[model samples]
Target chain A: MGSLEYRCLKATGVYNVLSEALVEIRDVNFAYGHRPILKGMNLTFPKNKVIAIMGGSGCGKTTLLRLIGGSIKPTSGYVKIGGQIIHELDRAGLYAMRRKMGMLFQFGALFTDMSVYDNVAFQMREHTNLPEEIIHDLVMMKLHAVGLRGTHDLLPAELSGGMARRVALARTVALDPMLILYDEPFAGLDPISLTVVGNLIKRLNDALGATSIVVTHDVQESLKIVDYLYFVADGVIITEGTPDEIKASNKPFVQQFINGEMDGPVPFHYPGGDYQQDLKLKSIERVKNNKRKVTERYFGLDRRQKKK
Target chain B: MMAALTKNFVGLGRRVMNSLWRIGIGARFLSLILLNSGISFSRFHLTVKELFFSGVMSLIIILVAGMFVGMVLGLQGYETLKRYGSESALGSLVALSLVRELGPVLAALLFASRAGSAMTAEIGLMKATEQISAMEMMAINPIARVVAPRFWAGVFAVPLLAAMFSVMGVFGGYLVGVVLIGVDEGSFWSQMQSNVDFQHDVLNGVFKSCVFGVVVTAIALFEGYDAPPTAEGVSGATTRTVVESSLAILILDFILTALMI
Candidate 1:
């Protein structure tokens, strides 16, 4: 029927690539002082999808969230959110941009002195000129979504660990941000709370049509809800795919991390010389250390213990 | 011996470098407090809460210390002035010492141990808990929201407390010097009135206390802001706040006395 148009398309030898990403991180490098944390890290999160960034602890997952939120500038490259570069923006511009982004820090990080109601109402009151009646209803609704409306007047310290995290989750989404970044949202919760939080994350992302990046070490729980997975180690993305592919992959790091293997690309012990040789050296050092401790000790306080 | 000497030199150099770095960061922290000081007025509720904690809570200790110190001064001055055949000058001695020396310096030292340390510990705990970062993620500035109100409360609270301290001290001195020891009340009042000038003694002490207030609170907040995020780190910050603020108050008192008195 359209023979001439089909021939013209085939002659171009081109194919369609991924659709546009909602948040793009291109060649981002981050470091604290001179020590590198993330090196040449690149990622893209699609609109209206939940993605998991899985890695060992101290693998710079929280650092990624900080980079996206413009809390810290990348050492090398750029992070672009909704077509705007984050680190390049001025303070006012950055804040204006962050209004569309929400983050749930590890350990809940609730305002310790505020009541549950006030915590949830904080964003609305600060960003909008809403009347008190409207703010109260909105705060109640958010708390209700997290099943904590009954605890409205409770201080953060009064709430249990799971309840506090749930309240924190409600506050993070009070503005219906375009993107939500959660750092270890399920680390300290019980089984029921973990599943509830996981489901809430997925359900809220879908309900708000918001992109989500969950930086966590909970592989199985994250695999249950995330649309895609990126497993990072030693400051680089080793592999990424759909949950099914990651579950079935044979890559060394992937297999080791997913199955909870003791040893793989990530070693269990600290790096050093051979074990037997180190043991011999360690014994000699132990004798020397004991002699030094007695000489350095004062009133039952060892210098080393005092340093600690 | 040379190696030990070299090691000592290196340690000294490192400490000097670290001190310089602390001073640089402290300057920036003070500038940030000044920049956000306007927000303290607008955020009146938080400032009032901070005042209750940092100001009202310090009052009991300040009052007790003031009263006791005043009684001691009254007794000591009475004995010494009596020997010089000018027992009436006891009021001048007590009033001048209380206004020009003891009230400002002692109140500030007490404040550093109480309110300043508490401020550092509270802010450092917030940082350790990631509450500061969470606020930033919500597009709120921590400097304005967290540090400003506390800074303003301390700066306003310290001078008021010093004035109260001096007043209570003078009252206590009168109780011991006149009512108990049988010094003539008329000479006591008249001598104090003649000797203690408002501008030179009282106002200058107020100015000294105000400056000490700023430096003490600044050290507190700066240490808190700069502390590493850990329990031990917060504890260390609290200790540093007390020590540094106390030292700063004493040094500032000396300099102000030389300049103003």
Candidate 2:
């Protein structure tokens, strides 16, 4: 373990050397108005490991990150991070707790007005009393670590999508956060950039010795880097295991998800009436329409012909 | 018939409840801004940059619009006063109109359309792009860093812009009345000085503009921060900012004017 991890673990004083889970979600439920998103979710993220939460869109993966980050409160139950309940903290307490956390939004979410250097330096400047010289070196080191030191002067708009994501990654790790959350970090990336980002997440997690939770749909890349995998569907964890176990499992959902099948327990189409019945009705309507058209053509009573 | 009536009543109640809920949220947001406004002042540079965008950039429109309004008032006032053999009172008419009513109202309307809309669009876009969320996750209160500076900047900018508008208006009136129409320059100056009271006219107008500044900025910021995180949502919020600010300014002007009178 790194010295920073040791110090953090020591400071928290809640976890033993063995089985040190940094975050624990206990029967947490969340909803937007009447629409329930997450229901009775129980998960543990261990320290110094990379865990990937895999799910289709709108499966409450991002919502899970928000819950862990203390941005939103769960409706019932709680999320405990480093021994403190996230939603129970007051504003000041929450902000203090947030200082130990970092989130990489799906689209980088860099301040478009600020350059890459300023973006990386933002957390340090805001949270610490460090002078400009130290901040400059720290920002540059972060940029270099992301392999984008040359693009430090560029605005987010000036950088490519991949470079922008890299800068955002650098910014996320700038404070050496104890827990890092990534929301679809591999989305909308070329092959090379995807691999680069995937490797960077692993390397950064190891170097910082921080617990990282990656919420992603990129199954292949996630399987390659993640220590454990949790598959979420319809707001609950359906299954979870190591990559090899997931690959070898006979569960229909797991097999379908892994193989990218067109039809499975997750259904290819939205819920609707009987497909054949609907198609037959449409065919009958089309036949009637065609007969009407033929009659109109025979009588030279077509709307187009009349208009002309 | 009974069901239809019940449904209509329910719809009306829901609309009223929603409006009240929004107002409550806006009040809470304003308090958050006040609570977090320390950084806006302490850092100061952030506020200054916002002021440049919301204030300095608005100068040309405020000045030019003021001039045109003043000139129109000059011609119209002279034409009306000439019928009553009081054309020499044109200066007093123009000055009182500009300083008392036209300056604050017109400047605020323009600011609502120009600076206020821009403020909403910027914040809404930031929210849509998740910059605000990123800031929150970074342990930075976005109200302090983003909203407060712009809020305070708009609050400071509107009154200054109004004053500039009034001053330019006076100059435009002078040019039209004294130079173009050949009204006696001494009578014009004397009449304006005697008729335009410092406290009643100038101070009240400044106070009105200050009230307008608060109203416009608050509405714009609230709409932006409350906007849904989507492109269409941001665009809608921007439109609402202008519409709501303009309506609020006009209504507030009526109340303030009635109270002052």
Candidate 3:
């Protein structure tokens, strides 16, 4: 059975219309033990739309997702979902909050010991009191959604990278969560699998009427479906807009990232002194040092004279 | 000179602090295993399966080693007793030596090598691969689902295995002392029956082995859980399991033996 909101959205044909904030991250600062990651990030994810949080490697995109999920708390400020502050929740309370949230990890992260069916049925088995028959039906339905119904008996290792990811996607949305966070969902994917996963993420979000936040550096697939975009760099949201607006963004870092440019604000080369000049200086120093190193620099050895 | 002295002091402090921290965390993990045990009664199959893996898998080594050690003890005890005309008490020596010391200590050492290292590697690989993180995302505690069954398995398995080792050891000593070396079989059986008390010898050895099981299993799980999420991390955790578990078994053996005595 489809959700009433999803059915209504289908009837109205305005599926992407976002209404009200489901997640609010305010002045959130996070660090991993003395090394700062997110430096006061402020953003909102609206319900009933796909939002992309894109950044280069090590730019704290995944940290923002983890913060929202309450896996790790922020150093300062708050992450609120439906007006409840996340970090203030007790362990039981945090787990209760997390039940409503679903996340897809970078790799599939499926349990190696379990088969595909078990992986998909994990959330249902843990959280629900449904009978095995109902759970089986539900698991099948979820797997069917990702076109992996036949692969149910296969172990995670047996599946290819793409199939494992699809199983992960199916597992993520199994509970029909109110929110979904995807951490690099399109990473390490072939073009064919990429399109299938991209379409599935969008379709599932709209069908389930769930708010979706995807943290990815895969600009092409992200731009295809994400309704809103935020480009993070150096631990801050430097630019945010609709996909069209993001493409037209003139911000140097954003342009460098989204346009896939070789050099701009984020340099192609590492930050160091002039390479050619340093090499020449080193060569000259070596030449001068090499001149005095034969016999004079070593033992003042007149071993030849001693032998004579 | 001041900087060097200060650095030495800091290094010493850090070593002490790290050791204390490990002990504290390991205790907490043990408590968690106990708590999870209550909930896992419904998951009886999982616990039984782990018992088969960790406990039943260790039977071969325990049996073989126990037999060999008993044979060696019988050979040595007969030689030593020959000089003093005390060869009649060979049965008591074999039984007491095995039930008091060798059974628990050697079985535990074997368990640590075979099963404990494997547990650490399995859990560490799960961590490195983000399966733990995935379980957390699903609002499921991995410790409850993964570690608890294995923990209870080791706790129950080790003592049983130690007892089995002792029985086999005594049998092996009988094979050598009475049958091969032509000792008086009646006297050998009589002396062992009289001297080996159920409460003092067998039960203490059982208790010691149970404690060792907890310590070894706890160290293995903790190292894996606290391991950095990488290939090198899992490998390091496995190494730590072997080294730390072996050292813990020896040190704990000394303390337990001294205190129990």
lDDT comparing candidate 1 with the true structure: 0.89
True contacts kept of 3: 0.67
Residue-level lDDT tens digits of model 3 in A1-308: 12345336535755435356789899999999999999989987778789999989999999899889888899998999978998899988888988998889889899898899999898898899999999999999999999999999999999999999999999999899999999999999999999999999999999999999999999999989998888899999888877877787788888788779999888888778898787798788887667645555575754555467
Q: Which pairs clash (backbone N, Cα, C closer than 3 Å) in model 3?
A: none
* Candidate 3 docking classification: medium
Kindly report the docking quality category of candidate 2.
high
Q: What is the C-alpha lDDT of each candidate?
A: 0.89, 0.92, 0.89
lDDT of 1 at A83: 89
Chain A TM-score of model 2 comes to 0.87
- Specify the poorest-scoring 10-residue window by lDDT in model 1 chain B: B34-43
Best by TM-score: 2
Question: DockQ for the candidate 2 complex?
Answer: 0.84
Error of 1 at B129 (Å): 0.6
Clashes of 1: 0
The alpha-carbon deviation from the true structure for residue B115 of candidate 2, after best TM-score superposition, in angstroms, is: 0.6
lDDT of 1 by residue, B1-261 (tens): 999999999999999999999899899888988897777898698889998999999999999999989999999999888889998888888889989989999999999999999899989999999999888889988999889999999999999899889888998999999999989999999999999999999999899989988999999999998889998999999998998998888888888889885
**C-alpha lDDT (0 to 100) for residue A99 of candidate 1:** 93
